[model samples]
Target: MSDIAAEFDFSMRSHGIALEMQQSNYLNNRICRPLVSAQATLVLESANADLLWDQLRRVAYVPGCSKRLAGTNWPDPQVVADELSAFISQAEVYYRAGEETSGPSAALQYYYSLLNLAKAELLLWRPDAIINQKLTHGVSAVHATGNFEDWRVKPQRGGVFPLLYEKRMGVPSSHLPGEINPDQLFSRCLESGMEYIQVRGKTLQAVPLYQTIVTDGTYSWSHLLIEGYGVIQQNKPSWDLVREIFEELPPLHHGNPWQVFALSSRLSLDSFALLIPCDGKYVRSGDGIHIGNLRLPEWEEELAARLRPMLGHPHGYFDGTLTVSLSDSEFVGLTSDLARYLSVYLVSSLIRYRPSALDLRLNPDQAWYLAAFTRQAALPALQSAANEILDNEFVFLDRVRG
Candidate 1:
């Protein structure tokens, strides 16, 4: 075996070996389940499109409801509320129509539904900026060749796309590339990750994240760790690679950036663990003050809140494992909301203008792949928009019938 591999093995075998096993079991059995269950209990559940539409419509008619729901106020609460209701009503029409149809026609209906929903959100948040102006789709197709993978979409400088980008990322859309590969967008989607892997035979852009708290009978600290070090090309995982991955992560709302530490000795090659020091202090040993006053459950809640922004709850359902990604050359840096929107936009555009191209894409062999995109993409987009509008992460629960 290589020296790097041997060092990694030894370190894994020796350093905190007992703690490592304890942490793993604790994370799997204790930490992950309750955190996900608690989140699930708090989210709004909807079994069908009608239920979802009703939930959203109720929020739309009330003045300053966005502020009340999400903690941010609209400038003209009544006007924005009225406009929001109208757009939502129209969006509901398209959404319902899309549900009843299939193929390219259904795709177009879903696109319009999402479009109106996006407009409602834009008006609610940026009333003065978009209320009276002529807004374009803000995104366009670069190439609509017969093959969908070969196609690309470009973001225009001015339009709803850039505005939404600015709203979500706090960065101007101009910073985005002149053109983006649809495949890259596909790779980042939580719903489409499996499809991406099946077709491309490569890992999705996201990395799985696991969390655990380690204690020595007196003092305890929470740690975030990622497996699958495929991002590190070399055998030895360098501090530089660790830092690069850390830097690519989205910034936390408050507090200092989490510190990266090697669980293994510096000489080790493969794996690493990151310490998210509570209150910005590294507690390597018992020298640091203990968290004796805080209950373990409370500490877990605190950690979940801190990491919520970076966590990807696949399809709005909190599975125990969350995901984060290292930005690569293929990544366009769009937020998940924007990625879903643009992805749907690309398909809708194809269906509308290039019917023959879409027909070719829906051939027997690839039909299931395209079907997955259609079936899975839109609901997340709506949920994301609703979250933005209400400033809350909402999950759909199936209605139980007696």
Candidate 2:
């Protein structure tokens, strides 16, 4: 076995005794239950941008809150707070202005809003990182032939884009391409799924994952139930396809594979269940899990992260279900937040610098897609960023009430 896998096995075995002890205590107490759900309901329904702004403001003004949230002490906490507050406030202004405008002008405002928001997020994540240094857009338009498919943007070495990419993915910007095309950006967006099908004639597959408990009378374990597998490829069960979907999942940690095993028998003709083993009997509080071990919440978050390449809101509106998509193409490591940001950046650039090209290409069909993108894309990006910034999952409650 490979060193990593061998080490993982050894660690699992070493924990077996403690796990058994905890399981015994858990059963004797009969109090183990699923922990508090990650989903938070916004009491006052507002725009996601507004919600994010409120959260960011708290990080800025609330003493010691930034350190608590970032998990690190800032050399100059006040400076970081001031910068965060400024950037967030500017972003809110742009977002509000974008909401009041329409057409390419709205796109321009929204792009700037997202850019500022990204900078603020960077500040929160890396309090000591330089933001005032000379930085380019980090991405540039390479081709714009008045066709969305032909439009392309290239990532530069040193810019806010690369910095964001590095911080989020733990990889250098050089790992990305010199240029990215529109189809790549659009195909990754869940909001653009229908548009992708209509334009590219290929369906994007996404399945909701239900969290539940499974047991064999002696031991109970957490499992994620995925239904509608048949819908992926028109009722044909392909193990290769299933593997592909799971392969997209990120590791629970740097060296450990997902502490999840597929119950092969549970793989029926249409659905499947993945067994997600806890480090010990599930505990209500975070204290029970070892700092080095992957916790249940982290497992769920990692699973959700795997779906990052397929851009869109990760949760269902009413049910708050987590959904994962099966890509028809290879993984490009283009997360929804980054892809959406870059896509809008590309559009705004065209509006600002190459208005004639955009005007010439703005046919009825292209305009329809552009309108759809402008309307639906920003929310998901904001929601995703808010989740990262606040270190929690938030579901706006307004839609359910409406």
Candidate 3:
């Protein structure tokens, strides 16, 4: 357990640096400093080991955490605290020897409980972090990312984790990155024992320090869908295959016949393109379709009309053309459904065709935008669509296959 702790701690440090939270000395003094300075000692003092243990057991009520600790329980904190001189010592032993490959251990359970108790205490002063964030447990894992365990404190690819602990703690922030006091935030992380790990610029760790306060595992179907997509996105080659599947799919609505295009060569510069019926010559504009060499103001309105549903109020400037971006919440919310509806097709299409021609690859926003489409169950719907496309194509099969 000590070895694992050491490794996990090391992972936390390395990941924090990679994420530019601790590595950039500038952030510590600027943003993290003030955050950490907002101490929760009084709260922690009020909640002792027994209270902490109870808080951890309460996690069974949390949706995601309950799922992880399926059939696990830890002893009362008083029992362990009375037996051992120090919590860390017994925690180390129980944590190390308690679990095998199959399931979670009592030690692991206690460790999480203690961590959450600390965070829950902090939440007393910094309620912003947990206010309406719907954070479950301090740790989570789904098969899609090939992570049986997710212990990072924040998300990778530019989110508030190591830099601003509040966001990772489920507290959203209005401040930009590196704009807050770094020193206090770093101090708070040390105080709370939260670990934010990133590998090769990817966030691999995000352990929610407060989630251990409960023991509930029930979750919504949406959570399961995202997990499914995470697994589907694991296959690199399948991205391109997903595009092919799109091309071969029949119209989502048979009478509408406005299914997305299959080949990259047939796409337009808008966020997405659909195969519209034309006599022979291509027609760009229609009731719903807005296309042409329009002025910036007109284009902006058109773009807003297209984006308003997904991004509430679309805001952007024209860099020779109209540009738009989604907030983190907006991106996740929109992408989650997109992935379920289009499945890999939406992801593959983005990879195959860019919203703008100048862009070389999917930007951070775009990549994450596509990530929402990774649901495995959606694949069957796509396959059914493909069969319909095949049935239509066979009527026009120019070349015979053996």
Off by over 4 Å in 3: 1-35, 38-140, 144-402
Instruction: lDDT for model 3, please.
Output: 0.22
lDDT (C-alpha) at residue 383 in model 2: 71
Give lDDT tens digits, candidate 1, residues 1-402: 122111222212211122323343222211222233122334345424554576688777755445543433655556666777888889989888877877544768888888888887777667776677788988898654657567898999888888887776666877777878876566656666677677666655444444444433323444455444343333122323334333322212111112122122233323433434533222223332233221345555665554443344334332223323223432234545566688788777777776666563445434455557777776776766665655444555333211
TM-score of each: 0.67, 0.67, 0.17
Alpha carbon lDDT at 35, candidate 2: 23
What is candidate 3's lDDT per residue for 249-313, written digit by digit as tens?
12222111111111223423322222111111111234312111112223234332432222111
Order the candidate numbers by lDDT, best to worst: 1, 2, 3
What does candidate 2's lDDT look like per residue over 1-402, in tens digits? 122212221112221222323343222222111222344434436446666668767766677665444564576666766777777778778878888877655778888888887787777667656546555678888654666667888898877888888877666877676777776666556666677577567544444444433222222344444444443344232333345444222222212111122122333423433324443333232342322122445544554454343323444322222222223343335555577788788878877876654452646566666667777776766776666566555655443221
Runs of candidate 2 exceeding 4 Å displacement = 1-48, 67-72, 205-295, 301-313, 318-331, 356-362, 397-402
Q: Candidate 3 — worst ten consecutive residues by lDDT sum?
A: 218-227
Error of 2 at 321 (Å): 10
The TM-score, computed over Cα atoms with residue i paired to residue i, of candidate 2 is 0.67
Better of 2 and 3 by lDDT: 2
